[model samples]
Target: MNKKLSYNVAIVGATGAVGKQIIRLLEERDFPIQQLKLLASKRSKGTIVEFKGKDLVVEEATPESFEGVDIALFSAGGKTSRSLAKIAVAKGAIVIDNTNAFRMDEDVPLIVPEVNMEEAKNHKGVISNPNCSTIQMVTALKPLYDRYGIERIIVSTYQAVSGAGNQAINELIVQTKQILDGKEVTKEILPVSSLPKKHQIAFNAIPQIDVFEDNGFTLEEMKMVRETKKIFGDPSIQVTATCVRLPIIYGHSESVYVELKEEYDLKEVRELLMNAPGVVVIDDPANQEYPLATDSAGKLDVFVGRLRRDLDHPRALNMWIVSDNLLKGAAWNAVQIAEHLIRNDYNESK
Candidate 1:
């Protein structure tokens, strides 16, 4: 395979939020594309999506979809990715999955390009995108971790409803209007859609994001804990998370506290983050400037601000991180891996 050759690309869940963003980015970044295949479930099969000014009809995803695909990006869900990712791999297409299906698989490379892009070269036909929250956190922490050995990380996330899906975003909008208009609030999707209980997200925050695991941590929180270790290639680093759902519509915000093995100067730490790739520092306390969810929406860079030393812990620091969960956190990260694969000629003599 020639690195300069354009390749056939397939996007699973082409009609979904992240899928749509991936399409936009492919065009925005000018990804080399010989052919583009839009795939969705049967319900969304006939839908048409505009890409590069052409209306492409989405086709139902099946095993044959990957026959000539050089790369397949999967974001449908765990079940869909689980059933089709291996099939795509068997058909000779490298699969970049955004679901939780293959992330923890020992053989699968869980990638955050800024943190550990080298891992992508070792992929056995499947690569996993880390959770949205984990993506931004790791992107911000990587520079710090490389400069000062990190001992532990404690993160509390204010995730947007959009992380759940388009439906959740709609629910938040409707719930807000209902509450403002003094109408009855109806809730169906939120917290955990599969769970029987539902909560209002318009005027409130849900303490849970995904289903609770046996360890008393939500699946979303556990993803941050486990994926951080895998992405960093260090199992000794400790991580804890509390994932919460906020009423925001686009970006995810995290309050991250990290304890480093060595003492660090605040000015040097800020300088390191400013120099890191795919990271933007917005800290200007005098001007009351910091990363905000609204400002981060639709951006590809992870925004970090509010860098301050922890009062009690000499080697610890606290910072705020924000990014568009749908873009850099999911679609852009997947596309970045694809770009890296192409640049490195992943298909040549591997």
Candidate 2:
């Protein structure tokens, strides 16, 4: 495909939390767009979504929805993407899907632009954004992985309710108010929404994010493990994850322990992080300075802090990583991939 003065763009799941942020980022960044289309479920059809001070109506996404679209951004659930993403590609659009639907697909490229934008050039029509938790962790680890090869990674995630979708966010807010009022708190939309059991998310930390697999790891945990390898393009690096849902509203934080193959200086490690693109290091512990979820909410950059050498291993280090689950973890990352596609004029033929 030849470069155009401007291209048509479509956003699936236009009413979702991440979808809204993608729209905002595109406008804020002044993305070159000759036309913009908002696509969502049939239930959300006819809803008005404001983009760049103009009202755009949400339309039901169908296989035909991709006609005339040059780029498609999907933040809808995996089911929707699985059903429509291929159709979008067949319709001559490059899909940047923010779903697990295609992340592990051998044909689809899993992308975190800060870490692996080069892989975008090899896309066979669909590119996947890594999981919200995985994106921030890998972005922070990329510089270190290059300077000193990573041997193993152990991560525990304190993820936000927003990652569970708007219903979970509302549950947290409503449950908090109910508890303060001494009223009976409602239990719903947590742990796993489809499962029969529900847990209170307000003032609570659930040890599971997605459903547990046979090996005892939740799907969220496995995604982090699997996607980390795929994104880094190195399956030999051992990774284990424990994903938990916290009561926070926006940011997802991780306690990461990485063992490198080479010994390193703490000062030099700090310098590498400080200079890394799309990373902000705030490690002045003496001044009570560190990355906090409250401070990271709404930010696009991944925040890293609490850097220190591991107690047991000379080459190991521990750090804290934080980012807005909806932005850098989802929307901003998707938009960045879209921007890369435009910049490189990417196509399957390329």
Q: In order, what lDDT does every prediction score?
A: 0.94, 0.93
Please write out the lDDT profile of model 2 over residues 73-163, one tens digit for every residue: 9998999999999999888888999999999999889999889998887888899999999999999999999999999999999999999
* Model 2 lDDT, residue 343, Cα: 86
User: For model 1, what is the C-alpha lDDT against the true structure?
Assistant: 0.94
Encode model 1's per-residue lDDT on 1-350: one tens digit a residue: 34658989999999898999999999999999999999999999999899899999999999989898889999999999999999998888889999999999998999998999987877889999999999999999998899998999999999999899989999999999999999999999997889999999998989999899998998999999999999999999999999999999999999999999999999999999999999999999999999999999989999999999999999999999999999998999999999999988665334
Per-candidate clash tally: 0, 0
Model 1 stretches with alpha carbons more than 4 Å out:
1-4, 347-350
